[model samples]
Target: LLETYCKASGQRINHEKSSIFFSEGCPQVRRDEVKQILNVHNESLSERYLGMPTDVGQSKMGTFKYLRDRVWEKVR
Candidate 1:
């Protein structure tokens, strides 16, 4: 389905850079199956986007330490 959509839209997906993130309670076998089907690798919650962890919940400020550090560095 993804391939078909990409073909129809003339857009190419870079599978090498793509990944699948499973929920905490997701079975390993099911996660593996999804990874295989999507042709993407597994990614941990620590994975970052734009220098910030992407999996942090809304109330988790510890994950934003990197952002704080960057701000401090800029302030100096």
Candidate 2:
């Protein structure tokens, strides 16, 4: 659908700037299939979304430490 829209509209999808977020319950096999369909072989996912961390796995604080550091820098 997105590819069709991009082609029709004459716009382009910068695959480097795209990331796919799957449900927690999604299996690895399914994820691989979806990636194959999307042709998103780039393993390096963008770590931030709109200036916030995306991969906040187990440690939200650890993942968001950069934000805190930025705030401190401005205050200092």
Candidate 3:
């Protein structure tokens, strides 16, 4: 999902700095410009997942590991 999002958006996540709590990464597209796009979407993406529950026993650790790798890749 993250890969697809990154590819389609041309944005990369900086994992070395990104925490499980916050979404931090380079905006391939400009903030001012992207905000307009997001505004149109009305924050649906964040609203959908921001407070969703997760299962520690079932969720794969690799999901987060992959995000961390991508974050460093973009930062580099």
Per TM-score, the best of the predicted structures is 1
Rank candidates by TM-score, best first. 1, 2, 3
**How well is each residue in 1-76 modelled by candidate 2, as lDDT tens digits?**
9889998999997777666778779898998998888877554547777787767899988888888999999999
TM-score of 2: 0.52
TM-score of 1: 0.61
Query: For candidate 1, which ten residues in a row score worst on lDDT?
Result: 42-51
RMSD of each: 3.1, 3.8, 15.6
Give the TM-scores of the predictions, in the order they appear.
0.61, 0.52, 0.27
Query: Could you give candidate 3's per-residue lDDT for residues 1-76 as a string of tens digits?
Result: 6678999999986644342321346363554455453333222223224433332335656536666777899999
- Order the candidate numbers by lDDT, best to worst: 1, 2, 3
Off by over 4 Å in 3: 21-76
- CA lDDT, every prediction? 0.81, 0.80, 0.49
Q: Show the colliding residue pairs in model 1.
A: none
Which scores better on TM-score, 1 or 2?
Answer: 1
Q: Residue 35 lDDT in model 2?
A: 80
